[model samples]
Target: MTAGSNSISPIPVAPVGLSSRAQRFVEVDGIRVPRQDFRRHRDGWIERGIPVAEIDRAADFQDRWGGLALPPAPFYEGGPRILNAGCPKGSGAEGWSFPAGAGRVSMPYGFMIGPDGAFGIDAHRWTPLHAGTDGWVESLALAAHATRWARTVTRIRGRAVTSLDLGGYEPVPEVQGVTDTWWRGEDSLIALYRGEAVGLDAPQCLEAHVYEGLDEWGLHGG
Candidate 1:
C-alpha cells in the first residue's frame, strides 16, 4: 500500500493524520514519524543495510544551542554507517514544541532520504571558493552543486565539509544565465539555485560556511 495509508500493517499507531495524497506533498516528505512507527518499518528493508529510525527522542536534545561557540556538534560524517540512526532536528513543524512531535534523529552528520542514496547532503556549500569566475559557467555549475547540498542536509546546524574535484581529466561545457541566492529564513536556510541559486558538481573542492557567511562568496580556490 502507499505510505500515507493510516492503517499501519503491524499494529495501530497513534493517529497519523496524513492522507495518502497529503503524504506525497512536499511538506510532509521530510517529517519524522512517532518513535514507535519508525521501528516497525525500519526492519522491512534491512537486508540492504538501511537504517531504522532509532534516534534519541527530540525532546531529549535542545536546539542549536551555544550558537557558534559550540562545535556545530549536531552532525557527523564519513564512517560507521548506522542505518537505524536518529532523526535530524533544528527547525520545522517536526521540531519539538507546541506541536510536540518526533522529527529529529541524533545523527551528527545528517540524513539520506531514500534507502538507495539517490540524493542527500554532507555539509558543504561552495560560495567561498568560486571567485573571479563570477557570472561564468563554472560558477553556475558550482552553484547547482551547493544548492543541492543545502536542501539535502537533514539538520540545519553546521557540519564538517570535505570536497574533492572528482570530475577530473575531462573537458566540460559552460552554461550562462545561472545564479543562486543563499539566504537565512526565519527557521531554515534557503537556496534559490537553478533559476537564481545553484551548486557545484561532484569532486570540486569547496568550503563550508555558517549561515552568516551564506551571502559572501569566498575566493575560487582558497
Candidate 2:
C-alpha cells in the first residue's frame, strides 16, 4: 500500500485464486473500482499472504466510506434508522433512561399510543398495523429504517432491544466504540435529533396494545 498526496492508494496486483468480479469494489479516485485493480498494482499482496487488515484498509478508505459520508450501498437491507417517532410515553408516563446498551422496557400493563401514531411500544415496527397493510409500510419513505432494526417490545418478560443488535444492514465503522453511528433520515428530522432524541406530535393513529396479565408496570403478572 502506498500513500497518495491525498488518499491511500493500493498498488494493483493480480488476485490470488480469485476472479476480479468476485472481489468487492471500493472508491478509488472518486470511482468505485474492483479489488483486482489494487492487486494488479500492489505486487500481488494476496499471493504474498500479507496481513488481511492491511489489505482491508487499502480496499476501504475513511473519507469515501467512513464518517458521516453517504454509503455507497444501503447500510441495512431494509431502510434508514429511526431515532424518534414523535410519540411520548403519556404524561405521568413511567419513563426510564438506560445507558448506551441493551435492555427491554416494561411499562404498566396497558395500551399506549406511541409517538409515531402506531400501536405497541415500538411505533416504527407496528407501522404496518396503522398503515392497514404491509404494502403501505413497504412504500413509506422511512420504512427501510423501521424494518431493518428489530422491534422493541413493551412487555417486560419478552425479548429485549439492544442498539447493537438492531444495527444497519451492512456493518459500519465503529465510532467512539458505538456500533450504530450514521444518522440517516429526513433532513429536517435528522437536524432536529442532532445528537439528541427528537419527539413529534402526531395523531394517535393506532393503539399500542399492552400484554394482558401484566402488572400496572409493564411487567409479567407474578
Candidate 3:
C-alpha cells in the first residue's frame, strides 16, 4: 500500500465511511506500509475508563507510523492521551472519545478518534472531520501524493473561500465529512477545512487548499 504500489487500485469514488477500511496501508518510500500498531500501548490505559470498543478503534490507527515521515501538515504531533479520563462523572463525553493525537501546534484542543468510528477535533465538544480515521489517513496520503505531482498549489483563506466554483468536481468519499472535505475534478483536487473554525468557533479560520495541474495518475491512478 505504499506510494506507486500496484497492489490496491486507486479508489474510484469516496466511500461512505472508513472504519472498516482502517486496515488499509499508506505509501512510504514507494512501498505500502501499515500504520503503526498500538496494541502494546493499550495495556497501560485499560483502567482509564476508555471503552473496549473505543480503545480498539483508536488502537487500530496507532498514532504515528514507525519511521514513516509525513509532510508538515496540521496533524497529530506526539501520541494519544485519554482526554476524558478526568471528566467529573456526567459531564464527560456522552459516548466515548479516545485520544488520536495532539496537534503539532498549541491549540485549545486535540484530535479525537472515537465515540463511534469518527475522526475529529475535541474542543470540549467533538467536531467530526471525517467519518473514520482511515479518511484522515487517506487525506494525508492524498496531500503527499498530490503535492509531488501538482504544478501549482494554492491556498485560500477567510471569506475569499466562499467564491470558488466547484462545478465539475466530485466529493472524495474516502476523505468526506461535514467539517472537512476533499473534492476531485478533471485535473485537480480541493481540500476544505472547517474543523478548526467549527471546533474553535472561529469563523475566520475557514480555508481551502487547492492542488492543481495533476494528471490522470495523480488524480486517480493507473
Candidate 4:
C-alpha cells in the first residue's frame, strides 16, 4: 500500500488474503464532502474487501470505500457514546452499545456499531421538523452542548441529556441551543434525544429528561 498525498491513500490488497480485522474495515474520505457526493470520487479503496459488519461501524458507505487513516477520535465527557438503549450485555467499547434508559438522546452517527437503530443527528441535512409544515415556530430555539471522549450527560432546562463521541467532527444542533430541539414538530428531523422537551417548562423539562424518558429517532442498523 502507498500513501498518496495528504488525505489521499492507495491502500493495496493482497493477491489473495487479508487479516481478519483488516478484512472487515474499509475507508472513505473525511467529512469535507457531503456524504451523498463522496461516491462521486473515483479510484478509492472499496476494492480492499472490508467486512459488512465493520463497514456498518462507519458513518456511510463512502467511508468504507477509502482506506484513509485517521487518529483515534478525541473524547470528551458527555459526547455521545455509551447509553441505555437495551444494548446486549457487554457490548461495545465500555458497554457503549446503547443508552441506559431515561430518555432518547441524539447521538452523532456511528457512535456505536452499525446503523442498527441509533439515532442519527447530522446537521448537514436540512431538517423539516424545525423549519415548518406551514407555520414555523417563529420564536423557538434549541440549547445543548457536549464534550468529546468521555461519558457525560448534560441537562437542558433540567432535562438530563446525553452526548456521544463525534469523532472530531463539529457539534450537531450546529447552532447550539437555538435549534437543538427546536425543529421536531414542523416536519422536522429529530436527531438524538433522551427525553421529551416538548410541552414542558424548562424546570419541568428536566423532571422528564432521562435516557429512557425520551424517545424520538433511533439508530438504524442494530
Best by TM-score: 3
Segments of candidate 3 deviating more than 4 angstroms: 1-51, 59-69, 74-93
- Give per-residue CA lDDT, model 4, range 1-222, as digits (tens): 221223423332311232222222222211121112322222232343333333333323223222322222211113232121222222244322222222123433222221233332222221222221001111111111112111333333343333332233332232222223322221112333322233122223322111212223210100
Model 1 local distance difference test score: 0.25
Estimate, for each residue in 1-222, the C-alpha lDDT of model 3 and write its tens digit. Answer: 332233432332222343323223232322222333345445655666555655555544443322233334533332222211111111254876655544556777776765666778788567898887657766766766777789999989887887879999999887756678889999999988888778878768888889999999778741
Compute the lDDT of residue 6 as modeled in candidate 1: 40
**Which candidate number would show the highest lDDT if scored against the true structure?**
3
How many clashes in each structure?
36, 23, 8, 72
What are the TM-scores, per candidate, against the unseen true structure? 0.17, 0.15, 0.68, 0.21
Q: Positional deviation of 52 in candidate 2, in angstroms?
A: 7.7
**Residue range 1-222, candidate 1, lDDT tens digits:** 232234323322212332222222212222222222333433543443432231223212212100001111111222112112234333233221111211244422232221221122223322211111111213333333334334344222112232212222121112122222233332233322221012234332223332222232221111
**Model 3, poorest ten-residue lDDT window?**
82-91
lDDT-better candidate, 1 vs 2 = 1
| Steric clash pairs (candidate 3) | 1-32, 2-27, 2-31, 2-32, 3-27, 14-173, 14-174, 15-173
- Our model 4 lands, by Cα RMSD against the true structure, at 17.7
Give Cα distance to truth, residue 65, candidate 1, Å.
21
- Cα lDDT, all candidates: 0.25, 0.22, 0.60, 0.25
Model 2 weakest lDDT span, ten residues long: 189-198
lDDT (C-alpha) at residue 98 in model 4: 21
